[model samples]
Target: MMASALLAGSALALSACVASLAVGAAGMAARGVAGTPTNNEQAHPAAATDCSTRASHYGKVSIIDVEQRSPSKIVVWGTADDGKQRRSFECSYGTKITGFKLRPIASPR
Candidate 1:
């Protein structure tokens, strides 16, 4: 009987531990701490606007990706009207905007 009681106690403790772990994981996910961006998390507004304005000179620019390189710098990748040509724009807050055209590498025939 004592052995049975011990087994039941152990099972309850294990289950409680697992339940707490599951709850903690769920809470982390809900709080966007699981390495995933929530809906509210997006590229900096000023960075996006600056990139768009600078890239507009190329043509009707379509932004592909926006990445924050640092607290004050953001890099935006995009394609112009042709879509074949890719470009990258780097915007540093309170500084100049730099743009670069990404050239496609020619494959060996």
Candidate 2:
């Protein structure tokens, strides 16, 4: 009888843990912090181009990733369609775009 009670208590505790985790995950999803892209990001795939015109220097390109380091600084990763070269750009903005730097990233073989 004691063993049965212990098993029941364990099951109840496990269920409570699962429920709390589910609630936390749901809350994160609702706040757009669950690794899902925000609506603006989904709608504008080429938003990186706004940061630097050099993004198209190698011809048409596709943005791979965008990281906002702060309210005024952003980094973008992209690949050129011409030679498939991957590159990264750091952009700093003030009243206008103040700084832009390009860094070539070697692609994996």
Candidate 3:
């Protein structure tokens, strides 16, 4: 029980740090059952170009994973429309998109 409490506290701290630095601090949700990938076409462009939009479009964008917030870029991940695999993307803040990729779901052990 104490271990879980400690973990929760740590997670809260981490998310707070990420939120202040960037935008969405999604990590815990991604750790669970991730969303699947989709080729909906409509969401593709926004997911590629905008970080925040991608967070809403795909699912989770790990602002916490991002080291440098500014001119560097930020990465976010979430389940896709397909509802099978998890999609990870690196995009600028409403500027330019860098990369997008789909990763296999990590089932809970």
- Candidates' C-alpha lDDT: 0.62, 0.62, 0.50
Q: Number of clashes in every candidate structure?
A: 0, 0, 8
Give the C-alpha lDDT of model 1: 0.62
Residue 79 shift from truth in candidate 1, angstroms: 1.0
Model 3 per-residue lDDT tens digits across residues 15-94: 99978766433554564456543333344344443655655466554443333343334444444433554554444322
Encode model 1's per-residue lDDT on 1-109: one tens digit a residue: 9999999999999999999999999998877854543232244666567767776776677777777665445676665544444444444432346555544434347
* TM-score of structure candidate 3: 0.29
- Candidate 3 backbone clash number: 8
Best by TM-score: 1
After superposition, which runs of candidate 1 have C-alpha atoms over 4 Å from their true positions? Answer: 1-43, 82-109
Which runs of model 3 end up more than 4 angstroms from their true locations? 1-49, 60-62, 69-88, 92-94
Compare candidates 2 and 3 on TM-score and give the better one. Answer: 2
lDDT (C-alpha) at residue 78 in model 2: 57
lDDT-wise, the better of 2 and 3 is 2
lDDT of 2 by residue, 1-109 (tens): 9999999999999999999999999998887854533234332234465653565775566666776655444556555545666666655443345566677777777
Clash pairs (backbone) in predicted model 1:
none
Which stretch of 10 consecutive residues in model 2 shows the poorest summed lDDT?
36-45
